[model samples]
Target chain A: MSVQERKQRERAERERLIVATARELAEQQGWDAVTTRRLAERIEYSQPVLYSHFRGKREIIGAVALQGATELAGALRAATVTADGPRARVAALARAYLDFAARNPAVYDAIFQLDGGLAYAQEDTPEPLKGAFAALQESLGEVAGNGVHAGLFTETFWAALHGLATLTRARRLPPEYIEQRVELLVDRLALV
Target chain B: MSVQERKQRERAERERLIVATARELAEQQGWDAVTTRRLAERIEYSQPVLYSHFRGKREIIGAVALQGATELAGALRAATVTADGPRARVAALARAYLDFAARNPAVYDAIFQLDGGLAYAQEDTPEPLKGAFAALQESLGEVAGNGVHAGLFTETFWAALHGLATLTRARRLPPEYIEQRVELLVDRLALV
Candidate 1:
């Protein structure tokens, strides 16, 4: 490999390291504790090096959110692939989405709650975000009834799943009723 | 009026004033700007007086959340009451819910996002919260279909509405599609 190519690869590797370290810190200690200075210390890099890759904590959070979106997209796609029918796939998708949020609370917050310096629902939205929506759309669109737009249906269904995930995490909903709620959502909403 | 009775009445009024001031301050400047010092100063009460009404910020937030719940219940009830049928009532309820969240962003945050020292979906849950669900169930129960628990169905529907509200607020979903999303949620989820 040429020297220039190697330098570019090293830069990409450092950026990945910074994002991974930030996500770890956020998951362990909450976002409030994930300051740039502390991230620098934990990553064993100078603050300047961290700043070189990310403008600040917000950009780092955006990176984590993007990585999280990519993961969520992959998980949703994998869960739906093995399901037998539209109804089963939708149910599996719901479970996978909720599980992702429950398992990765910090990353979920970065994508949904915190200011991650990411452009969402805009013309220039990032690829990973679009990918996450596409993941949901792939299954949900199949179940969206005639005369309904798939993208709109996906957004609505996605929002509902988001609500279930967040409210359950906040302890606003009974944990024991989670499966019942999911079943009800699928039975009631899925056209299949 | 008797002296003791008068004092009790006066104290209750003072508590209301404190809660209202804190809520207003929160709405205007945000929850971060809602320090006890600012609340006390705005209400023209000493810090001890503020403490007397509530222990600290968390309790103040709890008060706001309870108040917000009561208001939400009222809003939902008022909106659904005059609607022609189950479907129209559900649609009205959706509109009222999203409208409330948008109009009262800080209070909505208190009820959902922030830790407000409130019990939820439990035996010890607050009255206004119960009232809020009762309002939703009043309409949703009618359309819950056979053999399904209205409360569980209501919870699922509520989560969907919540997801729309929060995601829309966070800009995760396009604003222009808000009405379509609401319509889709009602059409898909509401049995009516």
Candidate 2:
């Protein structure tokens, strides 16, 4: 590779390493524990080096959220594609969405809960965030019912799933009935 | 009144003052701005006095959450009571719940978002929290459809509202369509 191209490749690799390390630290502890100093120490880089890539912790969170959004979109698409029909696809999507939230809570929080400094549902919204929403729309649009807006229906259904995921994680809702709750939500909300 | 009775009454009044001041500070600035020192200064009390009323910030949050729960339950009850039918009552309940969340974002965070050191959905759950759920149940139970456990149905419906409230507050969803979102949620999820 040319010298300038090699430098750009190295820069890209370092950025990925930084995001991965931050996400790992957040998952291990909590978001509060993912500090720049600790992240620098963990990545064996100087504070200045970390600062070069991210302005501060907020930008790091934004990076993590974007990465998370892409992964979430993929997970939902994968889950739905294997299902048999519209109802099945919707159910799979709900389960996949909830499972993603449950399994990678810190990443989920970065995308939805934390101040990741990401714009959403706007003209300037980032592609990964929009992709995640579109992933939901893909399955949900078919079930929006006549005379109802598909985007609005998806938003409502997604909100219900968000509620279940966060409440269950926070222990505000009983964990034992999550399966039944998922079934109830799908059966009632999805037109298919 | 006896001297001892007067002392007890004064203590109770002081406790109320502390909770009120903390809540006011949180509402005006956000939870992070609510420090014990700031709270003591706001309440015209020493740090020791504030600490005596609340073990720390967490206890203060718990107090705020309990208070919010009681107020929310009242708001839901009042909104649903005036509605003409089951469908109307459910719609009223949804609107009231979202309105309460929007108007009292800080207090809502205390009850749902922050770590208030509170137990939920348990035998030992506080009465105000239980009362809030009961308020939702009063209108929702009737429209839960056949065979579904009323409590589970209520939980599912409440999660949807919680999702909408948190997402709208976080600016993750379009604000203009909140009315239609509520109507869609009610029409789809509520059997009545």
Supply the DockQ value of model 2. Answer: 0.88
True contacts kept of 2: 0.89
Per-residue accuracy of model 1 over B1-192 as CA lDDT, tens digit each: 599999999999999999899899999999999987888899887889987777788999999999999999999999998999999999999999999999999999999889999999888999998898888899989888888898888999999999999999888988887898888888877776
Give the range of the ten consecutive residues with the poorest summed lDDT in model 2 chain A: A47-56
On DockQ, the candidate that comes out on top is 2
Per-residue error for B102 in candidate 1, Å, reads 1.5
TM-score per prediction, in order, is: 0.91, 0.96
Model 1 misplaced stretches (Cα beyond 4 Å): A1-14, A45-52, B1-14, B44-49
Ten residues in a row with the worst lDDT in model 1 chain B? B183-192
Error of 2 at B31 (Å): 0.8
Residues B1-192 of candidate 2 have per-residue lDDT tens digits of 699999999999999998898899999999999998888888888899987777788999999999999999999999999999999999999999999999999999999999989999999999999999999999999999999999999999999999999999999988989999999999989997
After best superposition, candidate 1 residue A6: deviation in angstroms?
Answer: 7.2
Error of 1 at B105 (Å): 1.3
DockQ for all models: 0.81, 0.88
